[model samples]
Target: MNEESNSKGIAMDLLQHFEDILESDPLIDELGFIHPSQFDLLNEESGISCNSFDEANCQSTDKILSEQSSKQENVYFWNKDHKLGISTHILLPLYKDAKHSFLTALKRYKTCSNQSNKDGDCLPASSSCDLESLLMRHSRSLLLLSCDFMTAWNSRKLVVSKKKQHSMFLNELILSGLVLSYSPKSEQAWNHRRWVIKSISAISSNLKDILEKESELVEKIAERSKMNYRAWNHRCWLISYMTREQVIDELKKSRSWAELHVADNCCFHYRSQLMLKIMKDSSCLVETVSFSHMVDIDKAWKDELDWNGTLIKRYVGREALWLYRRFISSCWINHFLTDSGDASHHFKESITNYHDFGTFLKKELCLIDYCSTVVDNEFGDFEAQAMHSASYLLWLKVKVPKPLENELLEKMRVIELKTLVEKSYPERSSLFNYFMS
Candidate 1:
């Protein structure tokens, strides 16, 4: 019993200290802490100032300033350890106080949640709405410390549901975005944002503008972190509600990003999804579409193919562009090149369209040959590049007409390609041999 009382007293003291710091706004010199001039010099060296914490108003200014002070002090200690170094142990008490405050708020929230549950009413009564507000404030504090805390997020959702405040839902989005700015890959934070959006959609009518801005935000995040699968997945989810024109606009914008990031398969996969949506749209059906629209679609596919070819030549060892080529080729054969007939007739026409299919295959083969020759003559890793190019040719060979397959798969060339692959990548010799056979 005495130990419990002592623990309670410590928590109370820490809480008092935290509140004091917030209300007093004590300067560094006033607290007998580091000098103001020294703090300014440290901020200059780190290129970050305590004043910057004011801009991130998502959290309490006191906690944010403490964290910033801790970071700057650590950096200063490292840089000045040889001359006038001071121990950074003073910051430990600040962090401990923050942790204590977080835990105290968490405990209070749990108690409030349990009390509401036990009363058989998840929603707080009008008389106890103040309790709900307090719980929400605690949740916000906890989330600022650990954005992935699902329990705190759930509590906030419950509070919002009970309050039915449209403004609160909007504020939740800002909070989640602040979390994302620090941890871009937090699934829980992203999920909370989605929930907030869903709730807002129930009330707001201007969601189209909001979603467009969201798409742009995801694009910026993708640019910072290549191959962010979650961001790409969110983008795909957003496409279901997009208009045909908006989808086409997004497709055009994404083409340059995909070309610049040749090795990121996520962007290529996203492109394939967008293309499928375009092809499957009712307005794009051959009977309903204008001649000009059909011509535009054909031109887009041709341009994508040419772009993929260029990327393949520029980046020799990348397989993502090759995979994208397969997607584009299959889509083109199924939708654009073949006539809109029965499956058997379409299959037959795909093979017999010498003007289109035959020319495409010949051009692709020439590209492969040119790439292989360049790799052999100029690149230091001849065998690896040769193997990559040869594997692509092998894929193309299977797609050719059976009568011309043997002609395309010349025995001497296959043997030489196999020998180079075996020498360069001996670990996969068995797989290579099996494929060759």
Candidate 2:
């Protein structure tokens, strides 16, 4: 044989010898893993003879297969002292199995550093597919593989590979605690998982994607908890990572859904807080429909606000009152600005006429006040604090404008007087007085 062919044959014989040793070792029956480094020592020291094999040209699948089957018998032998060995000729099938074994082994091996080494199996169907597409298709599966039981313990510990560590940590956490467990028993695996999730850097785009996924996870958590407070708390924390505007919009939608389904005052109290958060964040950002729907909740609710001790009673009332207060505050300010400038004519058509502020406030404002007081008395909760603050500021601003002050004060007095009369008179009788006043 040529000298090159002779060297290759020797390499193949040494590989076969390492495999034979693994098969003969009694540990393979129980542990199911063999250290690669141990295989390296057998290659250097065994001095096995070979007639036909090439170490550099690992092109013959038949040869690789013959070698693999011969070595398969010795799977559990360990030679930790030998430097890690690079296999010369690997059969495709055996290579895949070895990758899986390595992944499994690394899970048990603490501090395995070369996680990407096992990823050779995860490459494309052929040589043409790029790395990005390969990862996209197999990220989750590969992540699971890398974090398999006992794999981390057996593999070379990699401290420098941040990306691999991230994958490992994520998989560990997900399988540990983020998922619903049938057994109420907590595991160290779960605590470690949470640590990894928390340690994820906020600046990373991948972390952002994970944060989005976390919303779905929180929803799942809520399902497991039956809409419990702990689930809601986690949901809120996840939402906090998103933009304020988006978070509030999502919260508003969630609150509406919550109000529709949840009948407890405490739950409604939570919804009210969510609404109040949106208003406090930026009242102007609130949509007209959400705004109008809130203020006119009874109108939206069709007198459901008056029902006896319903959770909706208190929450709807508070929301309506808050909306009314905010609407008037906005209106008063707009009108005061118009009256101060050349734009005073805009109100001549709407204000003095009962169609604008006069009749609207007479009916709506009274209802809002009654509901506000009902919320205070029944649930002892107040959502009008922001609106109240806005109104207080507006009140101070309009003190110097006599016409604006007089008009708003008169409207306020009428609302109060009508509310008092409603408490004393029959419903229809109060309606007649409300229409007359």
Candidate 3:
């Protein structure tokens, strides 16, 4: 009984501290406020005291006064900005109130949870309902202050389960989104949102609509903060539920976004994931007399390669674009240009009119030549960006199969490329020599 009374008294004291701080603005101002006239008065006092001293003492007094005057000027300048002190006034009340409320709710929830765990039986329905309401209210309040509060989130989960409030999962989705609005990178909040969505998927029939809106939400968040891997990851998760056509639509929509953010490797990585999904969809492989679906997929792949080439040409010295090129090239070789006799007939037919393996090799070499020329002209010899471009070309020369007609010339070009890079970037000469050998 005394512990309960003591807890209530502590809560009240915390609340009173909040009120006192909120009302102490005038006191804070009085303590901080200084006037120009005060400096004059201090100087006058120093002068008067110096008059009663010897010559040496008077010099020391003057020096001390000058230092004191400088300090006063600095303080006065700092205090002139009113908003500087207002943050403490605003945050003190919020922290005190949030701490008090969070502790109180946590104590009650822990007690209820402990009792249920010990008894191995659920609480009475009415008690469970009341506790659920309490937990929901306080947890929401606490999460608004600190979105990553895992303990509060777990307690709310317990309450929802005890009360069988599965319907509340939708509301939890809304709440999680609200939390994410302020703390977009909060892993705990994002994880909770995923759990809420999964729960709703099991119970609700409108999951398609929910997931579509979720995809839009994630896109908006990604736009606001470029290179947000978490938002991109969530969008990738949404693709599993979407149809092949829907996934393709999303891919086309994100093309411009990815192009604009060429340095963001996450966007490129997400695009690769989407393409993999499309490639794996058996429904997309159904043939038509005039045009096979594989033809359309091939066209998409070609367009992506063209787009990547354009970006690489436009933005010289971007490792991300080079990395994306490698991804596209690897996917192309594995899916369309496989030398294995076991390759699918549909895949071979799709690339019949499109560039064959040799043509693709020539096109990639031409791109490398273009990048090297641009890097040379824009960023002179020995630039690190040039080294990056050279390294990528060297990697391609080794990884890609040589063309039939000019294999010797291609090998000579590779040797020249390595020699030029070795001369320009002597630091990496050893690695370049290893590649050459």
Candidate 4:
């Protein structure tokens, strides 16, 4: 019983200490869990005894604050500058403390709510605010330990919704972001951020800045953690809140990152989402769009097509680039070809009528033929390249206007498409045959 009591005391003390550290330094943006031995080694190297922080707890507040400021200059215990490090030794204890405190507060809040409902009168304003503050504080630590704690998350939503303060909503963003600092892929954390954004949007006019920062956060997180779908998904979701100019700027800004990471489809998917937003905005315009604006949007689409082709050739065998092309091409056909008015077709061959469509088909066929005949090395990247090209052409044939199908098939007949596909990807031959028939 003594050991259990000591453990509970230590755990709560650690949890309280962590909370204090956060309160003192709210700028802590990154979190890492280091083994306790590492903390000991750092302390030993610095000629400070271990357990110094524990001892400082009993000191006068002034002394503890002075020591904390002093400690900030060193690599630091618990926190340094903009990052927080937690020792593995205390994680279990801290988690238990946090979970216990959270559940206790949550139970109390719910019971009070039930009583208020039963009595048909609201709780006193002071009492309600106190319970909410208690619940929020406890849940913050609990979620840091276990991000998927659904009830804890839902409780926060309940509290934040009732208060509806803009600053409180932003605090929710910070809390969710902290959870993301450790767990970049936490669906609940990401969802909480989206909820906060939506709840705050009704009263917040500075959403453009918020959306920009959210996008930057995703990119920063993505840099550290590769291929994070949730991060990219969050970025894509920000598109809905962006203006048309912001959407275009994002597309241009991602160009360099996309070039550096030819294989990461998430960034490309983000680009595609931006492009789709542009298309949707153009289609749903409240007034007639200017000819110059239409030309600018058209140039943007053509530029994307050209850029994708460059990457395909430069980074051969990249299926992601090829898949992105499929989406872009289909959108081009649907928007520029079938949906364009007669005037659009007349300007610089811009509307891309059947004539411009024919030019596109020829360019694509030339591309596939060139890819299929590429010289190879032992890596067989060329083989994969040929496979992608064959499949892409075959896929494109089906997606083309029905009148062009026979023309595409006739053009393909001269290229030995079956033999080209069979050499690298025989499984898709049946698909080709299906399309051919």
Candidate 5:
């Protein structure tokens, strides 16, 4: 009974050992594991034949060979789960020996990486941690997700010597979506490409080379999806990342491209956003139209009042028109309230269309003589505050000469002095309230 019980115990231990091996073995291409390409270095280059064998051991040897081949394939694809070949087979014996050590390192390293990111070290590190870079101090959490355990280990060995390559691995790991965001893998891929371009070392790679490669990536993605805001945003980021002259040149080139494709608002909106970003960053607003040929609003209609009438009749009923009017008002307030940009041109555009709230108010004030209507009485004071506020800002901007430069200041001063004296109505107090605010 003792011997039988001992035999059963030995069998159970063997069973448990097999189970552990099965669990530890790397995954085979099953389920959602779609292998996009199969260029395994070992499988392609090594000419060792696993097919031929004697009859006695043929079946077992075939199974072993197949498993070994699969493992080899996995390692070379590194992006795929694979084990090292014969040279590293010795390490397999040590796997059990070092299991606890490996697990401890993995846990400690992952925690350290999370802390680093939480500490906001990723931004500065991102410049050096890019795809194709062969050197980075730490792989961070990237090592945990890489399918090729041995390759990942080898890559880490190069961390100190080949900084660029290490960075590149991190970049690839990110693009591979083994780290960073997983839900949007493609986004991570594109971002990784951008990061890699931006990470080019000044010692190893020319700045122009990096900028060109990034521009090419941007154009490639932009061409693939012209409406991709992310691509456009990346392009803008790349341009901003480049030299000052490069930024301006890129802006000019992209602006031309944007204007050529005016059939859709996506490009228009992209151009506007890019221009806004540039203006915000440089604090240099381009007042004059980049393109020489202007769309004549006067020629579009017969007269200024006719243009306003046409605009109101055509678009006043639209919700988009109301939203647009609000947007124009907001833009004016944000961009031109303190007369930050071209004051005259901004006001001219705002007041050009009757659908514009300010223009609408101008006509209404002339008719109402600042008196409250029945609707105003019901709504409690008309809340015509938006219109009144915008008019007063325009008035104050005109009154303040310090906000303007020589040419624009002189031009606006004449306009402001003329309007201030000419318009003396009861609602003039509303202008004072706006100025104070």
Candidate 6:
């Protein structure tokens, strides 16, 4: 019985040690699980091995942890470099205790909050404050151990939101970022981040820096996490809040990353969304639009169209590029070629003045004509190029502005495009014929 009591005492002490470490280090950005043997290896020099959670070993581990705490330092073995590691052996004990404590505090917090403002029905003010603090600390630890716990995350949100403390909201950002450090794809963590942002934006005004930081965070995560659709989706969602100048800046900044990742349709989609936003904003102006900004927008279109052509020529068979072209081409004809210069507003009658759009259509025809003539390679990339080009032209046929609706007939024939598709991709020839004819 003495031995069992001693072990329990050490376990509680170990839990306190972890709590103290977290309290001391608010900058811990990453958390991971480590093997018990590895934890022992880390403590070899201190003459302590936590290979067994038995009473004797537990006592020694607690002593060393105290010594390290007293010394005001912790190295990479368990906590260092702004990262915290948990031993697999103690994971169950630690998680159980942490989660239990968090849930208890959360229940008390809910009770306190549910009580009317009339007063004596709930715990006293001091006690309620302590309960909220306890919930926050416990929820942090629980989330580090298990990020998918929506209740814990939602509980934290409730506490922070009820208090509406700016510092507390910032701390929530740090907490969610820590969760994302390990589980970048955790939808709960990401959603919690969005919630925090929404809450903050409701009160704070100068959010340009905050939005920029969020964009950078997405890019940094995307670098390490491949094909992260959620991250990109979050970035695209941020476009709504950005200033027009910031939108243009984002366009210039994200170009390099997009170029390096030509195949990532999400990134291209992000770019298209940004471009469309600029057009939408320019058109929605009740006042006259900025001439300089309009000129810049025109230059942006020219650069993008030329850049798309260069990318298509350099990297043949990229479906993403073709798709991007279709979007930009549609945007160009509707916004630039039309008289009103607003695609989203309405399509005006500019058919007789289709001189500019007619030229744009000619450029597109030449591109597909070049791609379809390329010889097939071992990977059949040329064939894919032909199919995408053929498809783009066919799509453009139906999508052209109503004003220039019949103008495409004079520039390119549907029969010729179907033949281009059939040349390298005979299998889809009938499908193309059915759609085009």
TM-scores, one per candidate = 0.67, 0.32, 0.68, 0.86, 0.32, 0.83
RMSD of each: 8.4, 19.6, 13.0, 5.7, 16.1, 5.9
Cα lDDT of all candidates, in order? 0.61, 0.38, 0.62, 0.79, 0.38, 0.75
Off by over 4 Å in 2: 1-164, 176-197, 206-209, 220-227, 252-256, 262-366, 369-409, 415-437
- Backbone clashes per model, in order? 0, 30, 0, 0, 15, 0
Measured with C-alpha atoms, the lDDT of residue 32 in candidate 4 is 78
Look at candidate 3 and tell me the lDDT of residue 9: 58
Q: Report the candidate with higher TM-score, 1 versus 6.
A: 6
| True-structure lDDT of candidate 5 | 0.38
What are the per-residue Cα lDDT tens digits for candidate 3 across 1-437?
66555545544443444333323322221112224344334336546432343321112211111223343221111112111111122233444456667678678767876888898645786876676666676676567557777888887776655544566776677667766766678788788878777766666645667777787777777877778889888878877777777788778888888878888888888898888898777424444323456677777888899999998777767788888888888777666755535435655665655657666766776776555553355555325445666776667656654443255245446446766577556777777766655
Give the candidate number with the greatest TM-score: 4
lDDT of 4: 0.79
Query: Where does candidate 4 have its weakest 10-residue lDDT segment?
Result: 57-66
TM-score of 4: 0.86
Per-residue accuracy of model 1 over 63-114 as CA lDDT, tens digit each: 2222343333222121221122222332444335545555565566567678
Q: Which portions of model 1 show Cα errors greater than 4 Å?
A: 1-42, 45-128, 162-166, 202-206, 282-287, 337-355, 374-384, 399-437
Residues 1-437 of candidate 6 have per-residue lDDT tens digits of: 66556655655666667777788778888777776456555556546444443331232343232223343222222765577777665666677778877888888777777784555658767888898889888888888888999899988887788888888888887888878877889899888878888888899877798789889988888988988998898899889889999999999899989888888888889999999998888777624655555666767887898898889888889999999998888777766665564432322332223336667778888888888766756767887887788788778878886777677867786337656767756776777656544
- Model 4 residue 363 lDDT score: 78
lDDT of 4 by residue, 1-437 (tens): 66567657756777787777777777778777776447656556656554454432111121122123332222223565567777664577788889999999999999999988898646787988788888998998889889999999999999889878998998888888988999999999999999999898888766887888898899888988899999999899888888998998899889999999888999999999999899788766614676567778888888998999989989989999999999999988777766444233344254443236666777788888888875866767888899889888878877988876777777777688888878757776666667777
> In candidate 3, how many Å is residue 180 off?
2.3
Report the lDDT tens digits of candidate 5 across residue range 1-437: 66555544533332233223323443321112213132233334453222432211111111122124432322111211323122122123223323433445445544545676688553355543442132221232223233334434443434423555545543443333332122222454455545555445433444665566556555554554556666556655655555545655664566455434433344444444444454454334235533121222212212322322333333222222223223333443454334455434544454344233344334423322322122333443233333332343354344433433233333333233334323423456455444433
Question: What are the per-residue Cα lDDT tens digits for candidate 2 across 274-304?
Answer: 4334434433333333433334322322232
Q: In model 1, state the lDDT of residue 148.
A: 79
User: Which residue pairs in candidate 4 have backbone atoms (N, alpha carbon, C) closer than 3 angstroms, thus clashing?
Assistant: none
